[model samples]
Target: MSKELRSNFHEQLTEIRDGIAQMGAGVTELVPRATQILLDGDLEAAEYVILGDNEYDAKAVELEERCFSVIALQAPVASDLRSLVSAIKIIADIERSADLCVNICKAARRIYGHDLDPSLRGVIQKMGNQARVLFKESTEAYLNLDGPRAAALHDMDSYLDDLQRQFIQVIFESHAAGTIDLQVAVQLAVVARFYERIGDHAVNVGDRVRYIVDGWVPEHPYAESDNDPPEIVDGVIVPAGQS
Candidate 1:
């Protein structure tokens, strides 16, 4: 590549990277607070999150377009190509996670007048906090290309999954005890599920980051996200002179 071409590529790449960082930071502020919007019935805060979702969606679309432009104009290969691929995938995940935050906000509106069962409220709050942590760590892994840490996000996701399960049990218990009416229980359940889905999206970001660094995804989502060196499997990693 010419010096001019290389320079332009690097500059565009930096811009996209910075944009991804900014977007991640924006979403982080909302995930944990979304539950508060629900519990507190803060219509104002819920509206704020909904507006932020629009911004995230717009940014994601713009970043994805930039990625495609780079691919078409620069024909990036190797790590250069991987960078674009990672950005594309990460943006999608981030955008979806933000949408889930909006879902939580909408759920908050539906339950505005109905006080959540105390038991269910605790679990939802915990889930929201855990979701925030996952998104933050996932963004760090993506920006730093920390494959081992990114791979480990799955372990973190398991905790959120457990919280969701606990939410279910609590909801059932609350209803059985006549502490929470069926309508409120249903709304809180949707809110909990939204938080759980946000965690899943963060894990997806981690998966993409690991793939960007390592150049492959395990056939299964559950595969370890370690920095272990690759090994031969059948003909997959043939030796230097042995095809």
Candidate 2:
């Protein structure tokens, strides 16, 4: 590749990376905003979040397309190819996390006028804050190329899982105490699930970051093995395979 061509390729990759980061930042804000809408019963905020998802979805699609274009046109190899593949996966995770926030807002609207007990409210707040933190940390890991921090996101996500369990228990107790009816309890349970899923998606982003940095994917014990098929490098297939 010519020096000018290589420079252009890197610039495109950087733009895609920045786009993904912007999406992550948007999701981080959406989580807290949706949670507040749930806690405060703000229908206007709920509607805003619900409608805003359309724009997020559109941007995600555009970003994914850009990643694919770079792969097709530039024909990146080695770490560069890995980064593009991981980026596509990361973009999906971030997009889904954003959709989960919209789900939270929809749940809030469903349970409008319902009041949550203090115990339930407290757990919800903690879960929302934790979800936001998880995404923020994962984005930072991607930005800084911090593999260890990206790996730590899995452990960090365990707390969010615990919070989801605690919130469920509080929901049952609140129902038993007549603090909330069955309908509200069910909606709140779904809301808790939305928050938990957001954390899971954030962890997924971390996994993709690890892949981008070092070809480490959780499902694969080893990135490559002797039994594996011929490798593709620099747009050519090695060891007798087609280009």
Q: Would you estimate the TM-scores of all the predictions?
A: 0.87, 0.89
lDDT of 2 by residue, 1-243 (tens): 999999999999999999999999999888999999999999998898888889988999999999999999999999999999988888888887887787777677767887887899899999999999999999999987789999999899999999999999999999999999877877787778778778888888888888888888697542321122322333333441121
Error of 1 at 131 (Å): 0.3
lDDT of 2: 0.84
Give the poorly placed runs of model 2, Cα more than 4 Å off: 220-243
Report lDDT (CA) for all predictions: 0.79, 0.84
> In candidate 1, what are the lDDT values of residues 25-77, reduced to their tens digit?
87888887887887799999888887766678888999999999999988999
